[model samples]
Target: METASAESVRKHVRVYVTVFVALMALTLITVTISTLHLQPAAAIIVALCIAALKASLVAAYFMHLISEKKLIYAALTLTVVLFLVLMVLPVSHFADRGL
Candidate 1:
């Protein structure tokens, strides 16, 4: 029983390590993207996409959301939806400026 528990812990640790590496890679990519002189809209889109990916990874691995119950998943989904709605609303404000 102890060995099985240890194996499960090791699996979790491996997942954490993998996500950490991916987070690092995403950070590097974001940095590189920022150094480029992209159009403001494009840059914002890229940065937001990278941030979303990092958030997803952290939520899944570090927060153990992937293994959580359906109720938790539903809450997370609702949070993401709310966040998207809040973020996208600002784009309309920009659109009014003819950008």
Candidate 2:
């Protein structure tokens, strides 16, 4: 494997630190929102959105996915799509049962 240049290493470190800080800020926001007495559905939605953002940052920076090949990206996209479909299936079933 090619050795990374010092500048490149420094850039990666900076990016990692920035992502860490953002994750931390999102965590604080999550806690803050909990105390704000938002409606149950709204709170769940906001928390899930923040969690998704944090997950994205973790995947991109910590997992080194930001620089991955196209094949990896395509696989990741497929995984996300399948995950969403799985998640929605149960909800769709409940909705159909209610009708």
Candidate 3:
């Protein structure tokens, strides 16, 4: 029993280490992208996409949201939907104004 528990812990640790490395690599990629002279809108979109991925990784592994209940997932989905709506409203407003 103790051996099984220990192995489980080791597996979790390995997963966490892997996630940490991936987050670091993504950060490096973000920095490299910043130096590539991308257009302002393109750069913003790319950076936001990368940031969202990193946030998802952290939420899933570090926050243990992956094994959470369906209710939790539903709430998270709602939050994301509202966030997207809030983000788009300003952009839509600016577009309407020809900005």
The sequence of per-residue lDDT tens digits that candidate 1 reaches over residues 1-99 is 124487798888988888999999999999998999799999999999999999989987788777788898898789989999998999989999999
Which scores better on lDDT, 2 or 3? 3
Q: Write the per-residue lDDT of candidate 3 for residues 19-63, one digit (tens) a residue.
A: 999999999999999999899999999999999999999999988
Error of 2 at 68 (Å): 0.8
Compared to the true structure, candidate 2 yields what TM-score? Answer: 0.88
**TM-scores of all candidate predictions against the true structure:** 0.77, 0.88, 0.83
Each model's lDDT comes to 0.88, 0.90, 0.91
Residue pairs with backbone atoms closer than 3 Å in model 3 (clashes): none
Ranking under TM-score, best-scoring first?
Answer: 2, 3, 1
Q: After superposition, how far is residue 73 of candidate 3 from its true place, in Å?
A: 0.7
For candidate 1, the 10 contiguous residues with the lowest summed lDDT are: 1-10
TM-score of 1: 0.77
Off by over 4 Å in 3: 1-6
For candidate 1, the lDDT comes to 0.88
Which candidate gets the maximum lDDT versus the true structure? 3
